[model samples]
Target chain A: MVEIESMVPIAAVVDLVLGIATLSIISRSQGTSANNRIVGCILGWILVFLGLSYIMTSILEFRYGALADFSAVDRDKVGGTFAFTAKNLLLSSAYMLMVLLPFFFPFRLINREWDLWFLLAGVCVACAVFTAMHLMTNFEHFQVENFLFIPGYVVLISMYIRFIITEARDNDERLRKVSVVVGLVLIGIHGETMTYWLSQVLSINDLFFQRQSIQSGLSISAAAWGGINTRLTLGATAMLVLCAGEAWRSFKVGLSPFGVLTFIIFIIGFVAGLADLAVLDVVRSCYETQCEAFPVAYTIWYDFTSEALVYLYTPILFMFILLHYDIVDTKREENRWLIRIIVILMLLIVSSTILELIQSFLPIPDMISSAALAIVVGIFIGWEERIVKSLIDDSASIQETVPDFALPEIEHDFASPRLFNLVFGGVTAFILIVSLLFTGLGVLG
Target chain B: MSSDDTITSRSLLVTRESRVPTAVALLVTVVMMTVTMVDFVGDLRATDTFTSNTPDWNLTFDVQNYTMQAVETLQDDETRNLEFDMAEVIIPEGYSLGLIDVTITSEEEEGISVQCDSVAGDLIENGLTAQWNSPMSNLSGQDSSCQPIELSLQVYPDFDGRSITVSAVNEYQAMQHWLQDGWGQGVLSVDLELDVNSPLGFDPIGQDTDEEITVDVTVIMFKANISLVE
Candidate 1:
């Protein structure tokens, strides 16, 4: 019963609330700009709307359960079982967006100094597209939704990539960067899974549009994502090691008791997020029972991505706070060492970006996209303005006249030929080519 | 483009201001829509569940007769002592009742009578005939419309150990009346246990009242027209 209930959309309400609360907390922390706050508020509204839908759908599910066991039903009642299921899934996704938007609400892009209502208006357009997708999904007009929603989703992803690259980097720390990378990767995986699911639902009655080749590609892409998860986790483990250094650095003189608690919670959240992804994989498998091996695996990978993102909530929130407060500096001498570590991260990001592009054409796995994104963020931490250098430097300056630590001195002769970035970049590119060749057979064919 | 030029520790943090992506994303969205349209239009008439001209049948079975002996007590065990030495059963031909083979015996006689009946005519017109010439008999005969037979044996044995064997090779129609005693495949699997009346009065035997005679009848049928479907 608990499993079934958990599967239901009811928990989405709690997620929405938590998401909104996190934003509020970020806002109250005082460093966030007004533009950031507005973005957050809009996202919060979206979350609330999504949460309501989840709650409504959950209630509808309850009604369905009640009616199913009975021998009789109302004669006039229309739009039967499929309608209900579609409604739940559609509304739940809209609510999922609600739950998701606040976490990475593109606030910095909207500025008090500049009139960016056009951008805000763009947000409105994205929301409208999302809402349309939601409606089409609920009505089971899957192909139509895919035709519409994929573009909407792609647009959203591109905007987010730009947003993160521009606004988020300034104050990033290794830990926060790791969290963002992991979160975005998870998001990408979710998108891919959604795409696969949509494609299947759409292809139910159609054969001539049988993109068997695309299907084959998606399968391999999903598997590649699985391989990437192992890599990402390894990257995360490296980040955790770096975080340990951060903890040690802050432990003696600068650490607040609350900060330590938050850090611990963040670790817990990361672990929880990983577990959630595993669970989501199982859920995806359940739905993809009839699908071939590769597609099923890919679907599962996509599921893992979403679940991981959702579960990584606390850590992501805490890391954001830490970045905002200048507690963990990404560009600090210790943080600069992460460049060697995050080469794999960069590789993951680049590979994923390529895969994402290819998948747009041939339906490659989303996990790859996520891995690429994660790696990108992982690499980005070394240079991110908002998270690693700016905020941390500002905070460090407040405590003591800290030196400009943007560029760290290399202690070893090995630093002259920095291979970390190169290796990661090369590997990521190689993976992208491999994935493309496998999925986009036209490339290999 | 440079790895160091991008990324942030705060990048993991989803800002309250994180707005939805627009321009670049919208263009991608439009392209995806186009692809979807092309796919849809291309497969306009092809659906999953299409079918034609194949008879769908499922395998199943039918249950028939189920029965048990009505009364086992109505049985007789006194074996009749007959002196018949020669007996013959004749089955008509052209009416195809298949093989009509039979055997006859007498308890008192050292050599029992046996014979094979091979007659030719329509069974409905000529009927089945069994003839016997016995050297020893107290009195004699019985006859039926389907099979005309006149032969009888008298007096029960003292110990009641006397045995009589009747054998025949017959087709389904020849044994139709007897088969009616038990019908259908499942029900006919077990042999019928019936009471056979003892021949009249040879009294005053010892109280070894275990007077029961069992005769096993094995009929090998050659042909049966079984109409399975209606």
Candidate 2:
């Protein structure tokens, strides 16, 4: 019986590496314009916050022996671990960044002079409120923060639809750039839920949650359940909307690479929903009889689809959005080498992890897997230059691609890379210290 | 390339011609969100109840106690052996047999004579499925001068009055583990022995050579009840 390995630690390394690389690029972006630099910095810090959060999660998983044993009811499992508290708080902070991201990125929707201050204030107030709420209630309301994703979800989805429509209506290829960026942002935030689109549509995701609740002896509150439903609804709705929009565009205009990606995800959701139904007995085992383990086939299916999408591929998605959209300045000679290394590193890392995951379930020999990994590394190394060139060759900011749709440039000196570093760096420190104090004082697990 | 075509977030929603459509889209979105929430709440409540429609009340064990008494008598006898089939003893419903204890005594029949009797009781391990090796199961006891001799045999493993916490999917499931069956259903053998002594060198032959023996047997039984500590 091969158990699913914890990807929290691996995700931690990937996020931190990509996140630090992104921020480093943003900090040294002297030749980039203010708006581009600010947008790049925001993207960088989103990854950074997620990276730090994953690190805390990995620590907690190690200390608790496994991450599956999370519960709000079990005292030793819940309020007793410090890393648990810090992880949620940090994640909520990341979510704050996510909620504010779409307003500025691709194009600043609300271009007020005080927009930066609003973004800053939003993160601070939201993080503080969530941290306090979790501490007061012992994380019973952790999912409540999911509500914050609402504004961002609506923005991303609406923008995606708007651009796709405009692109098709006017036959402007440039509008696809705007649509693609918006699509990538949607994936970055709601990718996990989007994979459950079929399950959410069938309204069976709630059964899975009920199974988890019974298994962990957690009594999920109405508010928590509502939060989960809200996220799933958003994700499911987004997937449906995208599927429709992309199918229309593909039929009306012909299939593009982005359209193909959307269809693939659509197919995955359909299949995953069927798989989830196939294992309904295993899922209900907690209630029917003693809890039962899922079949290896089902577990492998999940490992490849949802888990891979989340832990391994999301950072790649973000990186793509960064470079392919010209959010990160890829043209500089100084940045080129670093970007090349990150690309190759991410490719090799993802390939090796996938091979290892395959080995966990399949009866593949270690030597064979190693050789496969080596081959993958060699291939990536050989194609590194072409991959980087292809990625950066047409990397143009949306303003340049769709200058007609782009907002007029605001020439004010927006906050620099240093200010973002300071504020977000302070947030990181606050999370660490609060987690430490809470854990030491036995206030929360 | 002109400012007229420059798109803000508002351009998608803010059109004199598109206002009604935008309102409809917003209305549909809000309605769908609300409907999704209602479905979630409904499913959550429905999933909470199992296919069996089990009662929310849980079944757990609360330690309870009861005892059954059996007695036998023999007149002018030196030794009396009694065989009791415990299966014949009708234990109450929802109760379990825990252990059995036996006592033997010789009635004072030496009227004005300097005579004494030694009595012993032995509870032999027979066809009973019980804790034969437990230190609490005393098989034999002896006493002098008609003092009561007591012996015991353990019928259940670790049976006590201590309450237990049971976690199960439902009341019916918990009941499956609590209601035990067919453990104390065998023959209980009690052998009572007495050694009689005559007056000081008077009737040395055979007169007053016997003593009356009495035996008392007790079967301890228990039933477990439940409390909802969840």
On the 0 to 100 scale, the lDDT of residue B45 in model 1 is 22
Real contacts recovered, all predictions: 0.08, 0.34
Query: Cα lDDT of all candidates, in order?
Result: 0.31, 0.75
Task: Please give the TM-score for the first chain of candidate 2.
Answer: 0.96
lDDT of 2 by residue, A127-222 (tens): 888888888887777788788788877777677777776677677787788878888788788888888888887778877777777666344567
Mind sharing the TM-score for model 2? 0.78
What are the runs in model 2 whose C-alpha is more than 4 Å off? A1-3, A69-75, A78-80, A217-219, A285-290, B1-6, B12-32, B39-169, B179-230
Worst 10 residues of 2 chain B by lDDT: B57-66
Question: Candidate 2 residues B123-165, lDDT tens each?
Answer: 8777888888898889988876667777887777766445556
Interface RMSD of 1: 17.0
The deviation in Å at residue B78 for candidate 1 is 11
Model-by-model DockQ, in order: 0.05, 0.23
TM-score of each: 0.34, 0.78
- For candidate 1, the clash count comes to 43
The CA lDDT at B125 in model 2 is: 73
